[model samples]
Target: MGKNILVLTGSPRQGGNSDMLADAFIKGARAGGHTVAKFATAAKKIGGCRACEACWSKNTACSIQDDFAELEPLLESAATLVLASPLYWFGVSSHLKAAIDKFYAYTRPGCKRPLKIKESLLLICGADEGLGVFTGAIETYKGIVDYMKWQDKGILAVPSVSAKGAIVHTEALKQAEKLGAEI
Candidate 1:
């Protein structure tokens, strides 16, 4: 059986390069028979975690009362998590980071809820031209995967793609699609 995949995109621009890359991945994932849900963090009003330690205390995944509450169910049910974003200041966008911070709710001490995610994939693009430009973002992704104990499915970092439609000129889109399908 196919897995349930949750794709969180962190690009503020709706049809930007990273978003297009995510779209390709989603297309391939769906064609591979997996159920995929895409959440655009930049478009939502999700705030950073408050670290109140009251996770699930109010019978909710988080008590912040924002779009994260809507994402809680998807996070709980996902068998695979895909984080797609554009490199911002040598790291993932603040939008995606906010959602990631809320992941603490699941791991809070004494919390009963559990995340079903077993594997993860990463897709990142940037305006810079070298692989070194992705170091910080890759490190952050590695940290999350390690902490969650999730299998690393794959990572595709495309550089030198500053313009919105510039990714079309590169092979990253096809690579992302193939990775999604294979996953």
Candidate 2:
């Protein structure tokens, strides 16, 4: 059976380098017979975790009451998660980080481990080719995977690509497609 893959694209600009990489991964994942659902969080209304600890108390996943309400169930149901973004300040974009931070709700008291997803993948891009450009972001995601007890399916960090559509004609796109197919 095909796995359900949820792709969270964190790039604010549509058709940007990271977004293109996400699209490529989606293409490959679909070609590999996985059901892919993507969400562009740049313009979404998701907010950071309130640390209210009201999630389990209120019997809700999050207390902020924004786009995250809808995303919570999706996150629980997905079999795989793909976090796609452009490296920002050696970290994830604010948009994506907000959504990720809200995951605290699931870890609140009485919730246990909240996510049912079993696997995760990372697709990150950056302008600089210097060492450790993606280290922070990679470590952050790896930590999340460890906390969630999910498998780290893969990480594809493309460097020297900053502008929109910069990945076109590059081997990165092909690699992304191949990664998706392997998934």
Candidate 3:
């Protein structure tokens, strides 16, 4: 079955370099005939996880109502998830990090029925080059995949892409299309 892919953009800058990378993935995924949707964190007021712990008693649903309530249905329907964010301080942008933390709403109390995410992907872009500038973000994403038991689809890290449209030379767009086609 074709997957329902959710691409969440975490960059604050409009049409920032990282978002361009995500657009590549979205275009590719759509071309492959999968259902895809993209959401920009900057445009939405997604707050931090409320830590109410009320989720357990109410079908893993949260009580500190906000935009998060809107995401539950999306999560339920998504078979593949892509977290796209620009590298900030060698970690995921604040918005995406908060989104991840909010995922606790999906956790089961008994730990018997593990959360399910099916398949997942991560797209990260940084302004500097280094062996592991993305290590922190990658580790965070891997941790989420582990919790959800999602398939390890792929992760692409692009370095030195600060200026908008700079990714055109990095082949990240082509790679994203391939990722979509494969998924």
Candidate 4:
């Protein structure tokens, strides 16, 4: 049986470089028989975590009562998570960061809720040509994988691609698709 995959995209621009990479990955994942669900944080009304520590107190993933409630079900059901984003300040965009912060609701001390995710993949794009530009984002991704105890499926960081649709000229898209299929 194929796994349920949840792909979270951080780019605010529709059909942006990062989004394209996500599309390629989704295409391959679907062809591989995996069920994929995608959520674009930029298009939602999600907010950063408030650090209230009141997670699940009211039978909700979060107490702020926003779009995260809509994502809770997907998060709980997904076996693999794919985070695709355009690197901002050497890290993930604020939109994706906010959604990631809300993950605290599931891991708060004493919270009984469980996350079904078993593996994760990262896709990042940046304007800088240097490969080092992706260090911050990669480190953050690594931290999340470690904390969640999920397998590190893979990471595709394409540098020097800032213009929208620039990724179309690179081999990263094919690599992303292959990565998805292998997953």
Q: By lDDT, who's the top model here?
A: 4
TM-score of each: 0.98, 0.94, 0.90, 0.98
Residue 39 lDDT (model 1): 95
CA RMSD (A), model 2: 1.6
Off by over 4 Å in 1: none
Candidate 4 on 40-82: residue-level lDDT in tens? 9999999999988788888987889999988998999999999
Decoy 2 TM-score against native: 0.94
C-alpha RMSD of each candidate structure in angstroms: 0.8, 1.6, 2.4, 0.8
Task: Kindly provide the TM-score of model 4 when superposed on the true structure, using C-alpha atoms.
Answer: 0.98
Superposition error at 45 for model 3 (Å):
1.0
**How accurate locally, in lDDT, is each candidate?**
0.93, 0.86, 0.79, 0.94
Worst 10 residues of 2 by lDDT: 56-65
User: Candidate 3's C-alpha lDDT?
Assistant: 0.79
Write the residue-wise lDDT of candidate 2 on 1-183 in tens digits: 889999998999988988888888899989889998898888798988877777755466876678877787678778999999999999889999999998787666678437778889999998898648899999999999999888998999988887678778479888888888898
Enumerate residue pairs that collide in model 3. Answer: none
| Candidate 3 lDDT tens digits, 79-121 | 8889989999988888877777777766747432234468999
